[model samples]
Target: MEDHANSRHKKTVQPVAKARQEVYVLRDLKEYLGESLLIIFSVLLALVLTEFINKQHEKSQTKELLNNIKEELKKNKQAEQEQYVYQQGILKRIDSVLRDPGLQKKVLTDGTFHLDYLAPEGVSLHDLSRVAWQVAQSHDITPKLEFKLVEMLTDIYDQQARIDKIEDKEAAVFLNYESRKPENIRETLILMRDNYHGWAFDRAPALIKKYDAAIKEIDRDL
Candidate 1:
């Protein structure tokens, strides 16, 4: 009977030990899962923080670049306005000679008559500086700017470049004239007339509009 009692006690003790081992295994599993979750949360938080910092940095850079661009534009506008005034005055003088019958008679009848009133292309040269813009483009900061602002900048600069090329061509053609002969004079005057027609009607208005539009857009951002 004592031996049977001893066997029964051993059975109960074995089950209790097994139960304790199971409890320890479950506790270890819970600790491991909690630690893994904590690691994942930390990594996600770090990634999110890094992204936010990058965005704010880009925003500051965009604002600084825009300010530089605005100042450049303002200077260009002033220079362009001055050129416009001088060229308009020159155009008036040229028209006075071309339109008046008396001046036409003087040009046709006089064999040695000199015309000093021809408008020089130098007076119409516009100020174009793209250093700030070039920097923004080269460094890839332009993409960080608002889409509308980027579009406006592209249009303005592209038009300015086109106008510069066209004006250079016009100047080259007019400046190649080496003779003061009446026929050469008349031909050059006609060329000037055509060039100025485009300038006064289209190019000048477009430049003023572009500058004003860009300034307005920048002001909204600032």
Candidate 2:
């Protein structure tokens, strides 16, 4: 009976020791998990800070680039304004010549402006065409503008044809004159060709392309 009691006590003690060991192991595992969690959170926080700093740096760079672009655009706009003013001055001078009584009667009324003023010297056909185009553009060309351009082109063509005949028939007349006259005619012809291309075609697409981006940006801003 004493031996049986000793055996039962030994069995109970073994279970108690096993439970104690399990409790110790659980405590150790909880500590390990807590340490792991802390490490993970710290790493995540550092990564978030790094990303925020990088984003801020990128935004600053973008703003700087935008400012530089704005400065360049401002300079270009000023230059364009100066050039436009100069061009207007030249047009005014041409208009004054055209308005003269003799010139008006011979060129404007008689429909010989291209021959008397433009084809002769000092004035250029390209300049004339550009002025006309600009005038039409400023006025926002419609059907009326189109009619004017067509009429202008036709009159200019007729005058040029007449001038070409005169050149072929009386080469000596041109040769005897100051070289400046013929040179002017040559330059005028080149200018006229470019004007024809621009007004009749070519330049419209370029203008459209120029405005397209600006319009889209405006729309985005809106």
Cα TM-score of candidate 1: 0.70
Sliding window of 10 residues with minimal summed lDDT for model 2: 121-130
Measured by lDDT, the strongest candidate is 1
State the displacement of the C-alpha of residue 186, model 1, in Å, after optimal TM-score superposition: 1.3
lDDT of 2 at 217: 39
lDDT of 2 at 160: 32
Q: Can you list the residue pairs that collide in candidate 2?
A: none
Worst 10 residues of 1 by lDDT: 108-117
Candidate lDDT scores, in order, read 0.69, 0.41
TM-score of every model versus the real structure: 0.70, 0.37
**lDDT tens digits, residues 105-155, model 2?**
443332223433434432222221133333433443334223543344334
- For model 2, the local distance difference test gives 0.41
Candidate 1 residue-wise lDDT at 213: 88
